[model samples]
Target: MSNANSDPLIVSHDLESISDVMRIVNREIWVVTAAAGNERGGLVATWVSAASIDDQTPTVLVGLAPNHYTTQLVEQSGSLTLHLLRESQLDVAWNFALGSGHDRDKLATLEYLLGATDAPRLRDCLAWLDCRVFARLVTGERHLYWVDVVAAARVHPGDALREHQLFASATPEQRQQLIANRDADITLQRPAAITWRKCLPEHLYFQPTQPTN
Candidate 1:
């Protein structure tokens, strides 16, 4: 008899459940900024985490889409600054999230200063960290950078913006643009994910063994 869990239809349903669960998980919003010579770029991101526990040797893991202009700048400069926006800074998030830096200058209207890492550090953020990429892993659709935090500052004392808050605060036009951007990203990343999975060794994938009666 075939196991119910092994049914393809059930497996597909499980995947959908996983996606639904992910959608509800609250994550902090971050603005990752980078500059390479004359070119500067910034993008809204939610994938950043502490990589080291030691205060003396501060490090963070930042994930950026390989196709993003900010990611390209990080690659060229090996440096970036991460900004934690306040709850009232939805406009700042929208500015970076709504468009690509390759199409227009995202930082032209924003107030920022050159950080110690030489990345653009937005002045209006709740907090900011200047980091240098010491190592990186190029996953299929994302570039994971292990960065050393060289400088950090808490600019303003306020509630940090979260993903759910951002969504709730968006105007109708902003919400529509956000959905369009997400759909475009899904289109680009799906094939890349499949290609990456294909390249991985078959043995690396889990295969359930049949139980002996």
Candidate 2:
């Protein structure tokens, strides 16, 4: 017997249900910034998290897709800077995620400074952490790096952006445009895995239903 959830049609219809659950997961939005010599690149990401609790050894994990220019720079430089975005800094998030560093300099248009790790520290962020690559593992389609947090600073000390908030606030059209732009960037990376579909699968969506007789 085929599992109903595994059926393509059922899965398609359950997209909104999946999104409803995911939006409340409270993943903080971040910009993973890096520099390779003169080449500077950054990308909007939510896949960063602390990997260790050792006070003497601050560690973080940043998952970067192999196909992005930022990922290449991080590999070559062996370092990265993670920036926490403010809720108001949506433009900063879009700039890094939608634009291609291969065609133009992404950091040139933004205000930033060279950190101790030689990574680009985005000035518009609420806080930043400079990390040194301790080790790397090829995890699925992403290069998951175990980094030691060498330095950190609170730039603004204000409310940080959350992935769920971004989706909840954007209209359908705005969401669609953002997803389209992101897809274009992912195409450049040509990874075996694709990003999760951020848009609702169809115009009509259903809320979670309780048992009704």
Task: For each of the candidates, give the backbone clash count.
Answer: 0, 1
lDDT per residue for candidate 1 within 17-129, as digits (tens), equals 78888999889999999999999999999999999999999999999998889999999999999999999998898888888999999999988999999999998899999
lDDT per residue as tens, model 2, 43-132: 888889899888898999988877778999998999999999888987777677665789878787888899989999987789999999
**What's model 1's lDDT at 70?**
98
**TM-score for each candidate, following the candidate numbering:** 0.86, 0.75
**Candidate 2 stretches greater than 4 Å from native:** 1-19, 168-174, 181-213
* Alpha-carbon shift of residue 87 in model 1 (angstroms): 0.7
Worst 10 residues of 1 by lDDT: 2-11
- Return the lDDT, model 1, position 177: 91
**Regions of candidate 1 where Cα sits further than 4 Å from its true position:** 1-12, 201-213
> What is the lDDT, from 0 to 100, of the residue 64 in candidate 1?
93
Cand. 1 TM to true fold = 0.86
